[model samples]
Target: MGAASVKPTSLPISELLSSRYPARVPRYQRAYAWNDTQVGDLIDDIKLLLPLPAGTRGHFYGGMVVIKITDSSEPSSNVYEIVDGQQRLATFCLLFAQIAARADELKDQADSQGDGEEAKKLAVLARGVRKSNLYYQRYDVDEGNESEQPRVRLSRVDDDFFQSLLDGTAGPPSRESHELLENAANLLRDELVTPATDATDLADARGKLQRLCDAVLLDSFVIHIVSDSRSSGYRLFSVLNDRGARLTVADLLRSHTLELLDDHASSREKAANLWDDILTEGADLVDDFLMTYYTSLTGKRAKREDLFDDVKDLIFSATKGRVEILAALQKMSGEVSTFKAIHAGMWPYVPSEHMQSVTEWQRSRLQRLVSTIQHKLSHPLLLAARAHSREDEFAKLVHMLELFALRYKNICGAHTGPAQAVYYAECKRLRGLTNGVAANFAALRKALNTLIDKRAPDPIFRNALKDKLRYDGGSPMKANLKELLTVLEDYRPWIKQGSSGQPRPSMINLIDLGQVSIEHIHPQKPEVIVPSLTSHTNRLGNLSYWAPSDNSAAGNKPFALKQPAYAASVVSFNQDLAELAAWDLSALEAREEQLIHDACLIFRP
Candidate 1:
């Protein structure tokens, strides 16, 4: 395609709505999910900085916020595929639904819901939402099986997130229809309805929302990038992003670190070459060496999470190259050992799955290790590791990981087995060793192992160690591992620490821990219909963790249908029980507060 063009305009982006995607473009084309918080942050920005002012420039710091679009051949239609702002658009529609539902109650409270006329004007603005809007076509798969056909057709979301917006739906429509109405209803609330009603007191707040939308035109700038292909786009995207403060992984990989050469093409070319070289994985080896060298001097870090900044620090202290870098990598072994020694206090508590009880300790260790490695390059132990020994250290560490990986593969094979106990034992053993080179091996082993357990140490517990952490960007390893570990936890007893603080004393209580088949608090499938657990998404508080067996039994059964099972398994559904008891309303009403009231507590740390 030719270079994409940028032209901003202000209208009631309200009328701008129409199907804007190629009908054939499939969900797989953009197969991913965005949670409520990400959506919430957008609204927060809109609200906090009304007229979402030219708050920040887009091209200067580009961020791809994807949206789904469809084209409808309707008269009086707007046809434009969402280019850069899909995430916010989709989420705003959802939030608008919540705001519309609460219009009447919120009429009195301005900050909470804006003014009264804004609410009414919004109602007038968003009349036939259910039929016109297409977001409401939600269905549940099945109750017992994941691959089953749908049972309940209209079910859009699980009890929590779905029920939330429904609580305070203000008017003539059924809760579902009213919600659909709110999707566009919010646009009216923000752009036209609310601001018009305000004279002075609400002057600023009233037009604020609408003004924010319009700001994108005047304030938002475009890159109008010239890239030949997807690869170029990816690299350009990363390069532009890294130049800003909020650097991403791809940014670290793409960043040139030199000042932008708007004036000097030669300088730009030089910088690009250096960046391309370092971005290579082999360059990561160089990066490691540099980090060891720098951390040897100052105290800093270089982790993927904070790699861009860390890389910045290490490169700043460039001690020549080849000779110095090789020297630094050689010395890195000792530096790793020293770093480990400094953070040893956090080890005992660490061998456990999470460090909830030791947040300070863990965060501190994370910071220190990052700092120690990248800054303290010449430290004696590192010098040895750097001297042709970096590869050996890398290999030794790799072997330990391979062993652990093999064990992980085995545990995953046995669904409902006690994977946590095995993992914990391995961690403790690794931590106890303190040899110079071996410690680095052990440290690497421990770090990698920690990554897995973080996602699912004891499956029953809610620690979601990320899949992206260990598997080197492949499939969803954590999800698969969780499924595997769940099996072990189901069949085995609780794995606890021995008096000697070992992981394998006995199996006492707890399900193959958190391992088991997918539990549908509200199951969906061909035969068994349950509430739409995944639909009408709100904060995940609505989606409680459940065992597959329990989830299956609860399928399609309204709380009423599942009452007997609920009574029988009262002990098993701790979170669901606590939440229902807290809400005090068995059948949900049209009150946003109820959902918020019940949910806010469960969601926060």
Candidate 2:
């Protein structure tokens, strides 16, 4: 049950796959995640050996760690659970599948050309490649019943998709991992047939494919590390990682947490599966989720490099026994759906008795406001509030956060350090709060409003709104500017009447309009430049959202010429601009003043 059962053996990939035991990536293992760069690099390295002389020493492909999951010793009866190097092994399987299929295509071409000898040679090469692929990828478990099992079985999350790739039945990828797998397959195909190496005939192509197949199957080497127990396998995996092997923060956390579980094998496996589900849900953002979740609970900053250490400390400090530790993780997993909804800028409807009072509109508005601002510093606070506070309190918290962000982040250009400190403090408080605390909301509002007044007072916001705000398409100010204009568009409709002095049209979600573009009221390249007003061309007061076609047609035109398009626009902000008396410095200043005043009122915390 420990280190004595661990064994290490060096083997070429050929021997490793040709063994009787079929390799299985345990359910807890992460899915195939090699990007195009990694896949291309591996292929390039393998291709480097093709030009070398025959019978050269095999290239070292690194280690593959596995554990014998079953005790049966009969041929093909044992399953080696892959603990590490699945990425490399899965990638090799993909490459072999492509080679076999390409060889088959070449064989078919030769047969059609009436070249019996070439066809026979290609058919044999195809079969050889197919056999190697079967050893690494899939083969029949029962010859009589024709039941088959993959030699290197991927996790349940990806086994089906990986199989489809080998069988050439994969459609467009439906998830991030699937996309990476598809990209890897496509990259291997590209490397297999480059422009410089493309053959002129079926025979030459067959030769080229055979060379690649041989290079892969006969020339690659790996250190096959085996263990008889899961705990030993994980310990070996961690030791290898500590010795400079690359593993992600999420991977380390999962491994460390599982290592702490002093339980039966079934319980350990269940915990591993639960961790995988959480990891899979987080996907690329798993590390961020871990950091934010831990920091929210602890009221301390968790850097990316120190995430595992922080979580480990928190686990030890918060739990007293094995059951409590597992429950702690289960509680953390429950918040994943909420975190995902916030990350995606969408309000998820989780049915709960306390959530019935929280209307969809309020939730939608909260999400839209945060999304428009696009700030991650607010995520931990929001996540903590959702987890600890009642649904209505969470809604109120969102509104306060939106106002603070609009003034402090969007308008006044302040550093995130100050706001992050306040947010973290609030998150810590929220994490400890019981349900239905009206006094906490009052204290939170006071703290946020106080911070707003200090960081982005009316005078500061006015000064920044006057001229410091500028946005070209490529500038980072584009998001803030869009958020400002969208809010103004909404605000203007409520306060101003229609063209016929009737009620204003209902407010629109200007940010979501597909064709909307930020148009300059005083065009960037006007027909006749007013020297006094040229400096104000890209200012906040000079910009409004317009349809792309209208923005284009009115480009660089004078105020009078642009007035017709603005008047016909659907946006209230644009329509109001059409009512200006003249396109002069005085007019720009007056409008700027009005906007500054309204912005202060609209965004005041």
Candidate 3:
């Protein structure tokens, strides 16, 4: 525990990976958790150091704390457990594996070209500078010890999959960690290969690839802090994480809660497992979930930076001991899935066992609507309602929220302040109903209805739907237009159905509408047009969904020339357009009126 017992050394990854002392990410540690952004950022940073000189050092890759788990004096006999820096270390291993693979591929190309000298050079690069930099040999004669092991061995959960990344035999990911690992490998491989694969000059590409390898292995450095024992390493890990520059709310909260449970090893271990499960389940939404989960439980709006303090306040106020704290965490763990489901627009449908009565259309509707609007403020309320209400009741709550977001936020362009206040208040009220009685649901529904009616009155909503819903070239309007057309297509009576009466496939996909274009029925820039109809060209009635090809081909042609394209289209919106006898202001106004009526009826609370 003394400063004398701890030793820290600054070394390049080349020295670390080339050393006989192997590093191991403990089984209980979290899996390789960096997402695509972090992985890409690391590669991009290294790319800045490209064309590295022979003896020049590149960027410092920060630090890691590892405990000497074995007491053996020989390096080969000792193993270091990674208490911190698993993500970085694992990422580097992945980087090296990809570079090695790229080098071997080039070597194969050289061999096929009958260039023995280039082939030999690439083979050395593939094997690394030393014979065993990527996978060091264990010199210990212990019968149980394997002859060769990866310099950085990941946890048991990801070790096999990590190996598959090196060998290039990975299949679909069965879990989140597996997916992350695969993504990192794929991203790194793509970056490493693109230059070499695209180069016309083989020697230049090979030199660049060599510099990349050297930049990673010889230039990038980390301060390797060696600890005397696991406990000491863990204490240092806690200190480093608390003061780390990139410390997150999840990190701070986890460290504080675990430190509080340190007295009971059993409770601490159980809590650690539960924490990992919740983090994995939350995935990229971990921070968002922390804020929303806290808000939902307390019915108070919490900022991300202030979340740890807010959570600590709750912990001190509500819990007395480790058991009580653990119980509180267990309850929080139960709600993580609900938060994830809500963010994914799945809600009651995710836990399908408990939500048997929730129909597929209901789930799809929420999913589509959520994708079309900014539903961040609605999360806390949705989480609270899902926790307190039954499936049927929660379905009603989701519909109410969707209508509010679509009408008030998306179409009417209302300010978010008033809506946020109403949502937070309802969240608090719903959380107060611990037993979730019928009267409580009724009250919440009534309040929500009143808010919706007040914010998005019939006349205001109808006018917006008819006029403001037109395409204005902004992404928000484009999304709103797509949402409107997709809903109309879903409600169209002519849509084909199965023998089982399930609705036909939708003409436009609400989730990903990038390929679908909003066609101007009246022609925005017509080759021939009546002067009076020019002003009505951008009306909601003038727009309908068209495939990119049809939109390009129509090309400002008059409705006469566009009629054949519309008649050939399968989209119900276009089919409706084909039925029109001629293009005029009267027809556009009539269609806009009918659309307004249908939208009002379909989105009714």
Candidate 4:
């Protein structure tokens, strides 16, 4: 328990690491995987390394290989961590596989026509190289030891792109966006993987590259923080979070304060101290601390990253120093009779309609009614709302206001942070209710956390929305963007004016209106299923993304419906979201031109 020893020294990569050493996986680092090009190019590099010019000799693989090392303490074995260069190691294994494959191919071609004894000898060496590929080994998911063998697997991104590039059949867009993918594909095709002339040399190079990569990169001098105890390591782990990119909104805000308050040096120190004091003060559960902070904001329902720019005070964090916590304390304590004057700057962004329900005089009366009990219950109330949304799946206790509303004067009392914490725990345990009280609260509280934490909802889910909503094939607007823009230009007057004659900014960008395509639930006449036309017609109502693709395929039949031998052509339905207050799909059949015209209006700035 005394101060433990601490030291860091760089050793030759191999000397620093033990065979089994793996870095203490940083909390933010993703799991191991290598893309096809990295893997594919690596194999090709070994085949060509000997022939390459001296200037480019080490260029393929020299970078700082950092890892942390821990000595065998009183209890555990010595350990080393790989901080960088994982991809290089994995790629080396891939090179081994390709070298092996090329050797076998050469041997077979030579043997088939009795070309020479060299072909037979080459086959043997290729097998040896192929057998050494540890990272590419197929995953034996359930067998823990089988996966550790030398092999490589191409990443999902690499496989698809390489296949397309090699085939030369993927005619993707010519736009700025598609340019990168095409370039990457072209690079892989040209630089990665080559024809092998001598199977034996190719085989030798693979093994050498594999051993070199494993020794230098995997075993290299990477920095790992270590102490004598396991628990101490856990404490050090917290610093990794503090320093890493997986920062919470609160963490970002904490960092932002420094930049914002720098102007007034004294106030800057004050802001830093005050903010931490408030965060530490009467801390409930960490989650609730986040909820309380977010509940105090405007646009409480939007994503956090979306709204982080509104933090103007962040620019002044240096001046605010510890005093910045005053903003939070004022926001929280302002409802009391003693603090009315403190809130002159806080009210405009307050969203609750009920904030208007309490006047200064009434706040004073409420304060007198419960001198010791806090009257402000919004923080805990928001937790209750979140629990309610979860169908009481997470209900832990009665909300603070709900407790107060219990109607027995003696039992109905305002709750403290500690008491609220207990109630939150109770709500987490609350049971089934059909009224959705639990669910409503659950979603709202989640929204509160998003407001506070400030991260984007995962992009995976957003892309999933595109597929679910069927915005993939073509534009929901005109098939071509230029033509569609021309059509939209004709409706400028209809779009630009709002009800009050002021120019209303457009909502067209909310979803990509341009990319939407009009799909037919029914196939083209020859393909249309004849049996249930009525049920099918309404189902095939056309929809599109708010962006590039629009109603190009409207009234066109799906191809499969006519050829019964082929699969029955059912239309891939878009989610059919309402662009207007009362937009419906029937408009696609009758108001086609008008629909396009109206949809374009949604995007006007």
Estimate, for each residue in 247-279, the C-alpha lDDT of model 4 and write its tens digit: 344434444553344355665455555444433
lDDT of 4: 0.35
Look at candidate 4 and tell me the lDDT of residue 166: 29
The count of backbone overlaps in candidate 2 is: 0
Per-residue lDDT tens digits for candidate 1, residues 1-605, read 23342223332223333222111111111101234344344444444434334544321213332222232331212122222233334443454443343333234454455555665543442332322322322223343322311111111221223233333434443333234434434554564435533444443433443354434323433232233333333344454455333333333433333222323555435444443333333333444544443433333333444555554545423333333433433344344444343323122122343433323322332222222122121122233232223333423332233223323332222231233343333334433444553534454445545544553233412222211212222344434333223323322222212113222212233333233433333333324433443332122222233443454456554444555555554233323343453221222222223322322111111
Q: How many backbone clashes can be found in candidate 4?
A: 107
Q: Each candidate: how many clashes? A: 71, 0, 0, 107
The Cα RMSD in angstroms, rounded to one decimal, for candidate 2 relative to the true structure is: 4.5
TM per model? 0.28, 0.86, 0.74, 0.31
In TM-score terms, which candidate is top? Answer: 2
| Residue-level lDDT tens digits of model 2 in 68-146 | 8764433556789888889999999898777767777777777788988988887888677656555433334454334
Give the TM-score (vs. native) of candidate 2. Answer: 0.86
Candidate 3 local lDDT, 207-249, one digit each (tens) = 8787777787777889999998666777788777653346566
Clashes by residue pair, model 2: none
lDDT score, candidate 3, position 605: 47
Predicted structure 2: lDDT = 0.73
Candidate lDDT values, in order: 0.34, 0.73, 0.72, 0.35
Candidate 4 Cα outliers beyond 4 Å, as residue runs: 1-29, 32-56, 60-83, 127-148, 151-191, 195-605
- Among these predictions, the greatest lDDT belongs to 2
Q: What is the lDDT of residue 549 in candidate 2?
A: 44
